[model samples]
Target: MIEVRDLTKRYGAERAVDRISFTVAPGEVLGFLGPNGAGKSTTMKVITGYLPPTEGTVLVDGLDVRRDALEIRRRIGYLPEHTPLYPDMPVSEYLAFVAAMRGIDASARASRTEAVVTRCGLADVLPKRIETLSKGYRQRVGLAQALIHDPEILVLDEPTTGLDPNQIVEIRELIRAIGREKTVILSTHILPEVQASCDRVLIIHRGRIVADGTPDDLQSRFSGLRRLSFGVRGPADRVAEVLSARTDLRIADVSDLDGETLFQLESDADTDARPLLFRLAVEEGWELTELHRDRANLEDVFRSLTSA
Candidate 1:
């Protein structure tokens, strides 16, 4: 539902977001990842119409973000890192105010406010002033304000920041539920958050698009080596010797314990040595007790692509 082409944002001589391009399909949840000063928030700002790009174009449902700024805003709900909130207003009152700002009519305001309150779990704190609530409640209030408009797209920058573990899981589940019906672009420092909440991963570094794909896709693409751990009831030297006959893999570590030997093998990413080892055990009268493979995960891919 969104498209960005060669988008760049600059402040004086430094480019916060270098020319980068990507698209988000309708009902897709995209995770925007980056290290400090990697332009993740800058890109979100440009997409949400909070900041204009220095070059290139952003289209929301085919409408140009520059020329149709107001229309695009109408379609997007934004929760910035530092939430814009009124400390004095009660949660219920605050939500109503934001609903009105989104152009909800007076007759519909109460119902709209009630829906967001229920969805955001603000019932108990409805009468409490925003300043009196805990940081987690404050975040809920911020999210309530964002959803009060019921926009088709949600742009959340570090939505789980400052939230406790339970709150983080709650927000992650909430985002996933929302993504089922609307497009979402989530930016956060937490890698597991991206894994649990986003369908696709997009990594930015040094103001450039470093990686973009489904989690599994990126992991497979960047997984340079595959390592396997094996346990067999046999002599360690003989086991290593038998396994070393293959030129595709090298046994990195071996040790014997309780009449069983453990072997660590490293091979090319595309190679799978399990079948060979299983057949070898059968033919050589060796009892195989355990076999495991260590695969590269999202963090590894992120580090490989974005780390210096």
Candidate 2:
């Protein structure tokens, strides 16, 4: 577990991380979200003991980050946004080197390297040079290096930044699997990734904590703001009248689209106006074409909290 108490970090006269406090329970996967220069990376560095806090304290497993910096580093695995990889080195050699650097004994270094290679799915590219691999493979290599020592907590920055959709899903599932037993703090701009992989979300803005909760919990804050749109081959006036009669749905907009009338309706997040609209279309003999739903997601919550 990790605890940050009024932690502050500054660069010269500018404050990178303002007074912020939070706790990460054991076995929790926390998603860290923020815009550029929002103190996310700074806080992560302080927690990992890569940077000293200007004020307050960070405790990892009851050990002070400032006092036990080396010991804390041993307990945490960090993959920065830009992975420090030697392009000329082969994947196998790089992993082995990292294991040794992490203080794994000569007897255990090979097995440690093997375990991470398997866990990170690097079997095929072990012999290839780091520069020869694609972005996704390089990321896998970075992750494998981070896991070489089997640290208790994992801190990943922009883990899936350049991956394709399929690769993203693969990495997301891999992170989910790792989160089952190890505490993970993932920092990325991919909101959907957080929704899919993280147990809870922590949003920081302007060097402070703005929002913290499960994806659903944050989305609930914007309930009743969801929009449902429909395209019907019927009179717009009649459709509006019928839908307006229902108190549960508010007709936000009515427009004439290509060959049909588009009706935009707003309703609570818990309410489903689709069923009743389908019934009305059937009873009124209206031909329904498009039925699309738009609801508040993690991105919405992030924008609302972080935007200036």
Candidate 3:
């Protein structure tokens, strides 16, 4: 579990991570999302003690990250966005060095290192130097080093950033497997990553958290402002008046496209207004081609929160 309270980080005159607070429970995969310059990395660094917070506390499983920095570092695995690896070192040699640094004993290092290599799919490249591997393999090596210590919490910054489509899917699946027992806080710009791998989302914009909830929760809350898109074959100019006259339906806008009428509408009635819209279309003898509700998605929420 992780807890952050009134977390603030400042650099000179600018506040990169403004006062913010949130909690993550064990076994929970929380997505940390934001646009460029949104303070996501700053917050992660503060939590990991890589950068000290100007004003606040971060607790990992009841141990203050600052006060118990060494212990906290032992209990958590951090993979920064840009992984620093010795290019000349072979995969095994680099991982062995990391295991030794984590204080793994000589009696246990080989088995532990082999487990991580298997878990991160680094078997084929164990003998290859880091510089000879592709970006995906290098990323896997970074992840292997992070897990080489067998930490309980994972703070990953853009774990899937430079991976190809297949590599992304593999990493996502790997993260899901890891989430079965460990708490994971994944920071990324990929919206689908949240939908695919996270149980909850923390959306930060302008150095503050603007939203936090499950994907469905955020979508439903913002979807109250709905739009029903449709096409009609009748005169476009009359489309607005025809729908507006209905006491139950609220027409947002109507436009003509290639001689076909388009309606963006909402309903105030207790029931869905689609049935009423169709009956009215039939009565007026206008051809009805399409009608579907437009529900809000994560992308919509991201745009609405981040856009000026």
In order, candidate lDDTs are 0.87, 0.88, 0.86
Which has the better TM-score: candidate 2, or candidate 3? 2
209-279: candidate 2 lDDT, tens digit per residue: 98988887888774436678888998778888888898888987878877699888888777777888888
Q: Clash number for every model?
A: 0, 0, 0
- The local lDDT score (0 to 100) that residue 50 gets in candidate 3 is 91
Top-down TM-score ranking: 2, 1, 3
Task: Give candidate 3 regions above 4 Å deviation.
Answer: 225-296
TM-score of 2: 0.87
Model 1 vs truth, CA RMSD: 4.0
Candidate 1 lDDT over residue span 113-165, tens digit each: 88888988899999999999987888888888888878889999999988899
Best by lDDT: 2
Q: lDDT tens digits, residues 244-305, model 3?
A: 77776677777777878888886632357777778878998899987877653588778888
What TM-score does prediction 1 earn?
0.82
Residue-level lDDT for 264 in candidate 3: 80
